[model samples]
Target: MSFTSARPEDLLIDAARRGDVPYLQQLLADGTVDVNVQNGKGFTALIVAAYDDQVEATKALLAAGADPNVQDVSGNSALMGVSFKGYPEVARLLIQHGADLNQQNGNGGTALMFATLFGRHNIVPILLEAGADTTIRDVRGLSARDLAVQQGNEEALKLLPQE
Candidate 1:
């Protein structure tokens, strides 16, 4: 059987993924789309926008009341996605919208861990300043500082607090 077409709410996610700010705005204005709707993977529009580096879209979603702390199936939040992708502006927006800095993913990885793992030096300090707990260990037993050391990210290591 042929699957049905996309729903209007799904369009919000699509628009956010494509960075189509105008379309996303229109969808929000219609008031039919739930800003916090999750896709098959459990990702909200804000997470998709942040993952795609759509700064404007990310901002619009936050302004429309998207939950910055919403996680996907893997427990990865919008902040983690932006942090991993090195989207500092999007990361900032997520944080400002009340994202839990210490929220851990399925692997127990926080935004700080993602930022450090990907060598996102610019984002590292931002997370640190936001009070991201460096002591939190991932499922692999690696803290953000540990990951920085493992990745040979000297700058990140320098920024991390010594154990």
Candidate 2:
């Protein structure tokens, strides 16, 4: 569909995904677009930005009052999305914006679990410092530490507390 036919919220999400900071800024400044508006997948602009590693877009969305804890259709939050992608800075920004560190996804996986499963070593510490519950287990009954060990993520395993 043409840009004219697209919803303003869709345009905002597209700006976030493309890292078009200027366009995003304009959208946010317009004050009509819902920063927390979800797409078909239930992913809000902040989630899209974080998932795409669009740091500036993420910052703009958060500043626009996007709820960082809003989850997608699969139950993945912005923090989890960024963590799974190994984008520590974006994860950090999400956390700072009130993203739940221990929020479990559809698979019962938290951002910490995603970080461990993906060997996102840099993200592990940030989640930890943000008060991620290491004791939490996923659908497979695996904690972050267990996943680290299972995935042979040596760096993550080292950072995890000894069980």
Top candidate (lDDT): 1
lDDT value for model 1: 0.91
Task: Give lDDT tens digits, candidate 1, residues 60-163.
Answer: 88988999999999999999988888988888888888999999999999999999999999899999998899999998888999998899999998999998
Local accuracy by lDDT, each model:
0.91, 0.88
lDDT of 2 by residue, 51-135 (tens): 9999988888888789999999999998988888999889888887788998998999999999899988889999998888999
By summed lDDT, the worst window of 10 consecutive residues in model 2 runs over 1-10
What value does the lDDT take at residue 14 in candidate 2?
A: 87
Query: What lDDT score goes with residue 53 in model 2?
Result: 94
Candidate 1 stretches with Cα past 4 Å from truth are 1-4
Model 2 backbone overlap count? 0
Q: What is the TM-score of each candidate against the true structure?
A: 0.94, 0.93
Residue pairs of candidate 1 with colliding backbone atoms: none
